[model samples]
Target: MTMSDDIVRMARAWIGTPYQHQASVKGVACDCLGLIRGIWRERHGTEPETPPPYTADWGEGGGQEVLMTAALCHLMPIDRQTPMEPGEVLLFRMRPGAVAKHLGILSAAGQAPRFIHAYNAHGVIDSPLTTPWQSRIAARFHFP
Candidate 1:
């Protein structure tokens, strides 16, 4: 299998993880970024750096691109126009003009792309990449 396949498999393995802020143990608890961090540890050796304390609006309080900055530091940046593939990371803004604070892994690509993410109330789920979600995509990256 390809590296992307391994990443996808690893991400999907966390499908039922309960959403918990600042946690990354698979199947037990994790948030959107936590899910990505868990997969990162499985693929890469160790986390680049521990993240600073963050609220649900991790990027909003001070209008800092906290998540974006960290993503750039750790992930291989993908051009925005690049066609997404399974295992690529997606950074979402949550809403227009807001700091991009949400994240997910592309689980299925091509015509009907889908992503796996842990939402506060929903936990980890594979969600359709609909127009609304598409519109919120601020950036994309892949494992280094």
Candidate 2:
């Protein structure tokens, strides 16, 4: 299968996985970052680097773009203006002045684009990439 297809497939497999901070095993639990980390491990044997623990609020207001920096270091950068497609990594800023911290993997694209993420109360699920979600996207990337 194509890499994009593989990524979507793997992400789908994590559907129903409970959201748990710092966890990464599929079907058990994972946070948004953990979901990305798990998929990376599926394609690459080792993680580029281990992440330090993050708080429930995602360490917001820290004045540091931690997530963006990490994505730049590992994933291939994609212009935020570029249309999103399956397998693309999405980094979001929860609020206007807050640090960009959320992450998701595009699962579908076109008229009704969708993404997979380990949401706090929703677990790992594919959801529509609605306007609000689109607006919060601070950057995009793809597996290196």
Query: In candidate 1, which residue ranges exceed 4 Å CA deviation?
Result: none
List of clashing residue pairs for candidate 2:
none
lDDT of 1 at 39: 92
What is the lDDT of every predicted structure here?
0.92, 0.90
For residues 47-103, write the lDDT of model 2, one tens digit per residue: 999999778676675687778889999999887677778999899998888888889
* Predicted model with the maximum TM-score: 1
Full-model lDDT, candidate 1? 0.92
